[model samples]
Target: MMASSNAIEGRHGDASPPKASINACLPCRKVKMKCVIATHAMECNRCVRKSLDCTFREHRRGRKPGTRLSHKSGSSISRKGRGDMSTAARSSPRRDRVSDFWADSEGLQPDSLLSHQAMRGKFSLQNILSTDHGGNIDGVATSRSVPPDDPILLGLINQQVAMGLFEYFMEKLNPYISQLDPLLHTFPYAREKSSFLFTTILSAASKYFRSELYPVLHDHAEKLYAECFRRGEKSTEIVQAIMILTYWKEPNDTRAWTSIGLAIRIGMDLGWHKLRKSARDHGGLPDPEWREIRNVERTFLVLFVYDRSLTLQTGKPWMIERNEFIESVESWGEESMANSNDHLLCSFVALRLLTGDAFDLLTPHRKSPLPRLNRLLTILQNRIEGWRKKWLGAVGPGNCHVFLVQFYGAHLQLQLFSLPLQDTNIPDMDGVGDIMPFWVSYQNSMAMLELVTKYFHFLYLAQDSVHVMTAYAAIFLIKILLSAPSTIVREIETPTIQAISDATKAFVSQCAPPGSSCTLQARFLEKALRDYSSPRNHQSRPLVYNETDNQCHGKDGQVSVPDSRVEGRESSILSGLDLCDQTQDVPDLLFGDDGSWADLFASTGFNIQEGVFFS
Candidate 1:
């Protein structure tokens, strides 16, 4: 019995301790801590120490044997397949070679085998902590403080090309945008300001330079923007870069409104909407402080301009409301002559504010009928004229930038007055008792064409707005030709229409680059003209005769008469009745129908007299 008891005791002592967990419990897995199970319990050491339940999750990591990488190049799994390969496997002589030429030369990490997906998703904690404060981890406050010779920062383009593009941007494009000052945004200043801004400068100038790096540079800019947006990064340079990209955007890009809206939001977040009162009060501030404050204000004004123009074009609501920030343009004190662009910018902002007023007056959202449209028209006209006179006098009419701004003012006034003519409800001036709107719109269309023809080369530089305005002018004229009453039609000679058409064609062909949105506008204008000039469309209209002599031929030698086929017995009955007294009232009769008079005339021409159109 003693031997048996001893044997039992030895067996109990020899039994192994409870096996520790091979897999981590859920809590341990989450925190990436090792799981140490108690000798005789299911709970892990970590869970027990924390007084929590320990549960294991069934998950198999890594890949199954003999499986190839995923076919999807964008998949994280595929990237891991390349990154997690054993060093021995990578050293095989027969394996595909990795391209690390740039990696070695640039002293970057050996990431040649990594996909763009990996690089985009890869973020260093240290780098984030550094850049989050708008500086490097090494204590640089801003990229501007970094040495301009940092090759990795300008890795996308050659150093020389970057310098050239920076110079070109300041010279050729900056005047139009007026965001960058040559004195402030020098080559070194731009190159070291921000990588995103540097890429944007190169991309904006690439088209004019005809550089082959446009596609690459433009793509890089987009990626950088996406990364910055994802990381919630904000800076003045980013705002300026966004504006540049929006101005010279990709063809058919739908992001213009959204992007400009984002820029405005970001700028507002940065407190760019308010002026620096402290800087304004203190005269002893450093030069850089004054420059920074000026840049902030300039950015806000430019953003306001972009927002207004884009909202008008897209028919979207205004992003920036009309506040004192935009309204204070006129009260600004005289700036030094060295920053003449400031005056031009201020004038441009004021003119756009006037445009904003015009937009507000005509907004479709208004529930009430337009109040005294004529009075409103006069007020807007005076404002636009005053603006033009002030700016033209300040900069002299010869300045190209000032001329462009003046042209925009003219375009706005044209749009305002022409609003009545475009209304479907009030088809003709007879309803409003205003022939001036019709004639003025016609004259503006003509003048706009002539002006564009004279200075298309200068205007083409601002292709964003110029192309749209030019197309609008040509199409508006075509609208008049096709539907205007005989009175106005007689005034528009054949030579004039032909001249405008030729100019439109030349502008589209010469100025519109391939793959430009202007090409689509040009095509639409061409189609409109083609459809109107077709003989079939004109043949459908009825013919009518001049009254008095009953046989007096009009200048065009085409008699006007109600179409018996369409009007049927109604025409015969009217002809049979005594219509001499009614002849004087024919103008009112032509517009008696609530439907469009242009539609009425196109379907059935009037035979009363030349007096109808004159009245």
Candidate 2:
């Protein structure tokens, strides 16, 4: 069988001879004549001969043709082109293109980014770039917490002392100030140090002033005044501080008053010379000018003197007698008259006389002996009108109008307080005719009211202390509302009152700790609101005595309802029976209850709680 098969193989081999060619590896694509397809793997004999790298997979038995071979290097090569190449090349270019498009569309240039970058580097850009979602990068930035030794804090301390809120502010700032020595001092005159001190003092002063901590404020102010005097550094700020302190203190001490007097004299002396020169150079107070700078100085002197007089009257251990102050004002008026300055003289006399007797005589029951408020109002109105006309051509009419408004409001307040509770009963003086004519000058009254309201609003808003401003504004609004006519009240809701309430609420919500200055105002407002709103005549009981009949009240001592419950009501019968009863006074019946009487009285002012009509 083997011999026969060898003879057959030899014959077939001769019939067809195989081609002689090198087998090539799939990866290298190189062929070699000595290449062995199976033992050398897929690599050609040439790659094997040259000792080059070959990443070809060995064919597996029964595997489908054209399938990817299993090899680590082949997998890596396939992933390289598909995964990383395009991405690596395209990322930077795409970002640059986007940035460029954004810049062009938004009108931003490359230079802006560069400039910003430069500035950022100088200022440490890391902080600027690290913004959270809130977009409040600098919102958390803190002011330099003033050191205890800082001059600014010292100034603030002095101001607080003046404003009477030192202890309160100190308590609030205790954590910070406690760490500092009382005598710790910063540089003598470094700008930052000075500014810091000044700002702190101003802030504290504003806070204390608003809080209405008057006692501590006055004490602090006096101390500061003395310190400034001792330092011999009487700059404008110091002088102003002293002036404000004097105003607030209304100092009764002879020495303190004398010092204030001296300060005033010094201010006057400095101011008078300048004013005289200005008048001389500018041609005698100029056209439409009613008062010169000298006049203003004199006005301040008069006001200060008047304030001192009031202090003497109201202050403890009153130094100056009321009669003596009145005499002095009379003399001042005479002097002003002698100088032919009727405006100043009139104003002086009017204020002095009005403030003394206006409150007592103007009320419903008290009789006034002084010039009737109507007369004063007339005089003021005429004067204001003249000034307005004269000054209109020169200065704007606004200032003149403002002056008129202030005078009007002041006079109105005085007059309102002076009026009898029943204004209708007070007959007009025969010669005066109807003073209502003057009072009815709606244009003037409205203008003045608007101006006064604005000023009050400004004060209320600008004040840092909620308690102080709220109290003051409340009082002011009360006074205004009380004096305002029913029509006026009906026409306008006080914006100042609303603002004060809102501001108080806000401040309380923000800065007021559990027990704080703001909380007091809040409580006050709440109480005021409640008190104002409670119903009048809440205590009055329905009259039922006359309605009790024997039939309704059975013999068995039990009450029975009638079949006609509506018509048989005993209360209605009693009301009719009591109507003509001469024994009862109508006024007594109406106002018998305290609630009714109190509500009647409360209607004169803003009763926040009741929301009643301001009569």
Candidate 3:
């Protein structure tokens, strides 16, 4: 029988054999073309070219020539291509696709398979990308566990002066960034909890440390910062570190713009923006956890202030949107809290809110008619002054100096709009009028100059914001000199101008250490003064009308009196304006397109995302 079977197989092998190409992908088979693929695992050329899902299946052996199929087998074969999809899908494919969700398994018991199947119930794209567990968002802890071998940790521990630097930060710098509780964030607690935060604190107070150690500390902090993001770590410490670094930003540093933005975003991710009803309404003596919550709230408010500051400085759009919770923060000062610094924070936040309101109010209507825009400006000014009247005398002790800088800073910020809005020929504006009277900004500039020059101690521990404020005042004074009348120009004693110039130089000196880039608003101011004295750029026209007899003539032949506050000074830099320079034709420095004050600041390369100047 074996001989007979072998002889029969040999005879059949001689007949036409089955084609192996039947396993080729459908697209290639439809075209009756060769399906070329580098390997069996990949798509064939034709399907790849068409961007189609290439699939192949094993072909069953053709029926024997003498065999007859039963009716049931033939009916099943007919139903294979045409049947209810659900019923058809219930059956396994002839070929194993090896999909994780549906591929058949062998060793697993039914219970185990059910457990495996349940794992995907909560699957989501964000969960898969951002969370450590399948769908458990909180599965990933916020407190980053510092490894013993972490370079940041080791560096801090090895430095004998690390604790000393931390003390310097707590003593000198902590007041500026009062969100951190000194008692809670003790040296050991901070060092052990987050190396990034510890390194940042040391870096901020590095002026007291060895000057050479600043870079090393900063580099370590930055590395840990990037590592935190890489590991998807979320915590209050990281956000505060970013804010601190941004506030005490390096010279020519552009990183603060985007760094603050990222901090705000991560803050939202941590739900800092969400004030739960229970979190807000908790009563009686606060628990330790509640204090932690309040600290978080304080940080959030500080972040908002930082955001508004950026908008005012760089003309960038703010990231944190206004909401009811933020709107109510101005009232937080009235609330009794265990921490005294919070009262100061409340006042600061209130000031920032007013500044933000000014930005929002005027930014959109910049092109609107000056009358409508001025109405909005007047409203903002009223609100700001109301804030001043209410909060000025109420500032906590020792906080008055900082509050004054910001108060005058707000005045400067509001006046900045005048430089752009003063140009009546600005192609976009609907009508011509000045919302920010020329005298208003002029007085604010003198006030700012007087404050900075008088306090002088501000330069010792001043943040970048204070330095920028000084620059704004100096630049505003210098630029207005062109159209300023000889009377007003003479009144601005050479000593005052020299003093203002010296103040700017002091700022550059303070912020620019060994290799850092500090604010160059002073350089531009010098350039403007030199150009003003040059023979070619000496032409001047009546730029502003000074108040004579406590009144001035408007363009409509109507008499208007300047603000009474403008009268107190013995000499005013912008007290009068009508200087005439006939030596050469010069453009209007305050209003002309090329000479616009806005153009001067923009020339400093203030792109936030690129970190241009700050980098």
Candidate 4:
């Protein structure tokens, strides 16, 4: 039993520790008996104390094949390696030799093979980055970067610049275009890049040049034209630029005429044949595309060819040869089949510019040379009158009601300017007829007067009345006195003059604010007296103070004391003191006791007929 116990102890206790051998770890190959992963420095306390290799075969009994193979390197099988070898075997040298024979016989570069392979690898990398990695390192993003020489983008930017330049060019060149200098700094680069920017700039410079910049603008325009022509870009756009330049040139320059002629020739060559044919066949209306082209052509033609002041110069009428152009225009109108609105408007503007003074020249002739002018004027007059009636019916009875009133006024002014100044007694030309020249002028003047009065009335009634009223006071005083007719002057008998004086006194009292522009007001009142109280008092009738009262008292009825003596007493008393010495002969009712007509006339330096002279 003792021997058996000793054997058990010997077996259990260690039996001389079994020659303490080292077993390298399959993963680490370090000196130790305990497993030592390389990540743990290939050492364990138990192996170090035993003085054995701190190594152990990776535990594989319960682990996966992949885990067991980690310690063996190439000792394990690989499906991918097996498949690759199989593929190589399938594409062996026998097959490659046949492909090489065909490829070599073709004499193609063998480097293409390597290049294609490299390209495939690059494409694969790009696809991987773009699809799987969400990176933008590929060439697609960089391809969209704008280049300085790109034609399309440059053209678009140039167009934007052109639009801005056209709007502000005149301001840039003319110091007087605006008093504000800050306006110039607002848009600088926009003016530099646009093609049409030079046109507007030259236009403004020509329009407002203070005689000093005339030569400058002229030289600039010439240089611009030469540059465009030299560039071999004498397109329709270049022609338009030249035409605008010519328009702003000195009116009498031979070069101006030559430039205009060249521009017209170029324009006609571009498409004027089709334009003229379309205009004639279509009756001022053509297909939309053709019409747009025609409109641009006509705008250039109008700007280049026609000058109203020049047309009116009798000595140089033939210098411009306006009659030929007018004949052409008339023929174009007759041939046109479709009448477009734009064409009609352009025709109206062109005709007015061409024939404004021809009407006057022809009116006195035994035979009218311009029957077509008469017809065109009649048509325009009717259209304008119809439009005026429509607007009048739509608007209310306030000053704002006349917002569109200027359109009618301008049309009438054009018509009046178109009338002949000859003293012909033609029935149609007489002021008594339905289409009478004087009747139209009178109507237009009346409308303008009404508008002026309404505007002043608005100022008087408005809440913030100071500034607006001051502006209107100057405008109204100027319009009323300056625009009234000589006929109206003659027909205002003593009664009408007296009534007007009373109204004037009332109007003046309302404008007593010292800050207003009262100089015009004072001058108007002085002029009215001087004009109405002259030797022509026999021709003048006093203004009617009240319409009802004037109507009730017949023209031949017994005389009533004029309302001027009663209504204007206070204003005349205050204002007459200043004017008493100069206006003593004028019949002022302010100086008399009880404001009697005779006493006031005697005391206030009143004269019945020899009117006051303010100046």
lDDT-better candidate, 1 vs 4: 1
- Model 2 Cα RMSD, 1 decimal: 36.7
Could you tell me the lDDT of residue 15 within candidate 2?
58
Model 1, 420-495: lDDT tens digits are: 6554322345644376566666667667766665665664456466655655566556556555555555567343
1 or 3: which has the higher lDDT? Answer: 1
| TM-score versus the correct structure, for each prediction | 0.61, 0.31, 0.62, 0.32
Among these predictions, the greatest lDDT belongs to: 1
Q: lDDT of each structure?
A: 0.53, 0.33, 0.53, 0.34
> Which 10-residue window of candidate 2 scores lowest in summed lDDT?
174-183
**Highest TM-score against the true fold, candidate:** 3
| C-alpha lDDT of residue 85 in model 1 | 24
Q: lDDT score of model 1?
A: 0.53
Q: Give the range of the ten consecutive residues with the poorest summed lDDT in model 1.
A: 606-615
**Alpha-carbon error at 612 in model 3, in Å?**
7.3
TM-score of model 3 (CA atoms): 0.62
1-615 per-residue lDDT for model 2 (tens digits): 011222122223465522222112222322222323322132223323222223222222343443322433322221112211212232344353343312212113432233222221122345335332122211212344433533335553353343333233323331111111112212232223333233333334444344444344345545555555564332222333443333222212224445445455434323221221111222222221222222333344443444443342222222222343333443443432123232333343344444443444444455543456556545654654554443333222322223332443343443343243233422323444343432333333333333433443222222111122234334334333333443443343234233333433333343332233334444444333223223211221111112445122223344322212123332221223221112321132221133443443344332333221132
Better of 3 and 4 by TM-score: 3
Order the numbered candidates by lDDT, best leading.
1, 3, 4, 2
